[model samples]
Target: MSAPETTTTTALMPMVIGEHRIAVEALSVLEILGPQQWVAIPNTPPMLPGALAWRGRAVGVLDLGPALDLPTLSAPSTRNRNAILQLTDDTVALSVDRVLEVCRAAADAIAPVHAASWVVDGGLPCRGEIELDELVVPILDLDAWAVASRRAR
Candidate 1:
């Protein structure tokens, strides 16, 4: 007779864009929201898609898929949703199909990625411990992204 061993599972926050999958640490996310009509910001870069009035505060919404120039989602309802995140001192929102789950993977599970166009942290082009499709999605540097948007003006 043998005894069974126990296995532990960690929670990971999941977001979807079409068939692709994106998962991050649940603690990294602040809130998950449903579809909301975002007012598009004109003359802004393709990355800075729009802004929404949240609790009397105007927060910029980033189109993660589009900002990376990835395929667009098919459904209009899916396109209208947003994922709110508190990165650094900024409270920015990301438009995603659905906020799936808050599941977890081991820290060693994530591997590094290489690409100049994709920026992960302030360090050289490398993917983080998060798995986001086959392509590397840059970790949002809210301060830098906001600063770049300002410079674009």
Candidate 2:
């Protein structure tokens, strides 16, 4: 008999942003914070609207709605949560509607995102798309997003 095959799986944390369901790599997420009172910075883009104090330091809050061409969160709700992401050289909080439990999927389950898919005017960076329970979810590319946001500044 041949040797048993081993399957590799990827861990992802699904989140709700606006009306869309997306996910991020489980390893990149540092923590999730509840509704925070962020200070909007003047002359800043809508995507990077403001910053919030976290652990004695200020962390920029990323509003993916504008970037993803979706409706921005208006009224504050108790369900709102901010996911703190550890990017290359910076730590920022992602404003999300809700944070879901982490899940893992086989490598082959993830598919490439089409060009015509939902993206920003420039481009909404995505690592890939995975279908979880018949729902296709795009995995945001945080590193790429961070770089693009900086360049846009």
| Strongest candidate by lDDT | 2
Best by TM-score: 2
What overall lDDT, based on C-alpha atoms, would model 1 receive against the true structure? 0.57
Error of 1 at 148 (Å): 5.9
Cα TM-score per model: 0.64, 0.87
Tens-digit lDDT string for candidate 1 (1-153): 888965554456666666545554566577777876667766765656567767788777766565444763332233645777775667777777777756565655555544323434232122343554554433334455666666668
Model 1 collision count: 7
For model 2, name the residue pairs that clash: none
lDDT of each: 0.57, 0.81
Q: Per-residue lDDT tens digits of candidate 2, residues 93-147?
A: 8988899999998888888886326753336688888887678888888899889
Off by over 4 Å in 2: 73-79, 120-122
Reference-based TM-score, model 2? 0.87
